[model samples]
Target: MGPSRIIAVRHGESEANLAYRRAGERPLVYGRGDDEVTLTALGREQAAALGRLLAALPAGEEPEQVWCSPYRRALDTWEGARAAWGAGPLPLTVDDRLRDQEQGAFARLNPAAVRERFPGEPARREAEGAYAFRPPGGESLADVVVRLRAFVRHLERRADGRRVLIVAHDSVVLGLRHVIAGAPDAELAAVLEFAPVLNASVSVWRTGEGAFELVRFNDVGHLTS
Candidate 1:
């Protein structure tokens, strides 16, 4: 009766996740020779667990369609969940809009490296909720929100009465949260300050009249059990 419910799920933990470096900051090497840098064993477990959680949802609340980022890590997560929902044959659209924000020179760097490279301004911005601070050749939190706004608007208009599952990255998840919460740009940055979106966490949204409400945020109901 309204815009379809959006269940935004983050991709499983990645190799960079365990490596103490943020993959988004690293160069684009996936689909070339980056399989080893995909998901970690724990990430695989987390994805399977998420699948079970999704499978357990009531049929009425289950997703009727699925969308995923083109990244191999995201696709790997979706594949891990295939069995839990019996979500066979349903086309999973790949939307680059859902890709993670580029981390610039910080992609494969640790905190120390980030600090060394960026110095006072970078650290200060990271600490003080600087959503608009764009790094060299990368995106800022504000940039991510802008992209997510378009995606949400499209979904709000194109979908109705069904649940849509979005398998995406942390930047997308964080942006979606800010969009649904109607947070001011300043506040949105505060929310992400050092709080990385965990693997396979879910954020739920309901939209109407060009607006959205965050029904749930960072929901790890599957992991609690």
Candidate 2:
């Protein structure tokens, strides 16, 4: 049986975001790898806010199963959010499938810097088409969708109508959306262009009529405060 509900949340603002904002004129040197990036102070608050929001949900809607990315930022969010969720066993499990997409040469380069440092990448990415384009050693957007699809299948098998929550990265959010949207591989690349992933936002999906339907995308009402 499929999960009754699935909530995908992006990790809150991270140190990378802060550094980017601070690097006004300088070429923001690579600070840390994607997996190593940690959430900022406000990010911790955002995670706590999410926890309260979830706690306020109807009991049945409260997440009974939590799937989180193994990355530090995502894990930190879960650690903070789970506190407001409940007192007993958290039922939280980390899955590598939900981790951020691997980055090769693009590991920590700013977008603008990418063109200056890796001149061939842009043309090659454009030539191959965004969906199928893989960086020097990283996976493509389509690759992420494939792994997310596998995670969905795993969810179908394990969720069994339970309310489920997924805390992960921006790419994972888009990846999950691409998988659920059931778009053709050709269209997968445009998913990000059309659906912007929001940090600390919750995207809710429900499955009942033999397919998943997105009931809400990027809901961040809790962060208003």
Candidate 3:
């Protein structure tokens, strides 16, 4: 029996997100480690807005346990949300498995940079497809699913019948969708193309009739509202 409800959140926009956006025609290079990236001002606001939404949930629906990634951006996002929550701290656990997808040798390199650095990688990735394409020393989306599968099993064991909140990265959110929905590998590409996970988006899953159903996917109503 897994948790009755699971609320999965992607960390708000980070400096890296901004850099990637501004890297038009150039290779975007992040100065620090991925785990060290921090949230932008707008990201903080988005997180606070998310917090307000979570805080407003009915008592019975409120999260009982919180899980987060150890990455700085994720932690900071949670802090901002918790402040806006104003309901005092919840039981929080930081887990590395919730961290973003590792790019390995391709870390901090944009498409152009990757091509320039490793001329053959782009062709290789194209051949392998996005889901199965594993970067050198990094993880593929399939690899992410492997770890997320274990995490979901752990959640089911420890959080049976409870409502839980998870604050993590975009990859984690997508991975959770794949794991919880029991979707096939072929469907992931469609989901990626049709349903891009936005930063600070909220996704909810609820258990019903012995199975988990998606209540929402990539919801940004809190920010828009």
Best by lDDT: 3
How do the predictions measure up, each by TM-score?
A: 0.82, 0.92, 0.96
**Cα RMSD to the true fold for all candidates:** 4.2, 1.7, 1.3
Query: In model 1, what is the error at residue 130, expressed in angstroms?
Result: 3.2
Which stretches in model 3 have alpha-carbon errors above 4 Å? Answer: 185-188
How far out, in Å, is residue 141 in model 2? Answer: 0.7
Q: What is the C-alpha lDDT of each candidate?
A: 0.74, 0.84, 0.89
Candidate 2 displacement at residue 25 in angstroms: 5.9
lDDT of 3 by residue, 1-225 (tens): 989999999999999888888886697777878999999999999999999999889878899999999999999999999999987768898988898899999898777778888999988989988888999999998888889988999998889999999999888898899889888876766556635688899999999989999999999989988
Give the distance in Å from residue 138's predicted Cα in candidate 3 to where it truly belongs: 0.4
Native-to-model Cα distance after best TM-score fit, residue 207 in candidate 1, in Å: 5.4
Better of 1 and 2 by lDDT: 2
Looking at candidate 2, the ten consecutive residues that score lowest on lDDT are 21-30
Candidate 3 lDDT trough over 10 residues, lowest sum:
187-196
Cand. 2 TM to true fold: 0.92
Clashes of each: 2, 0, 0
Candidate 2 lDDT, tens digit per residue, 118-222? Answer: 888889888988768888899887888888999989988988888899999888998888888777776776776745677799999988578889998888888
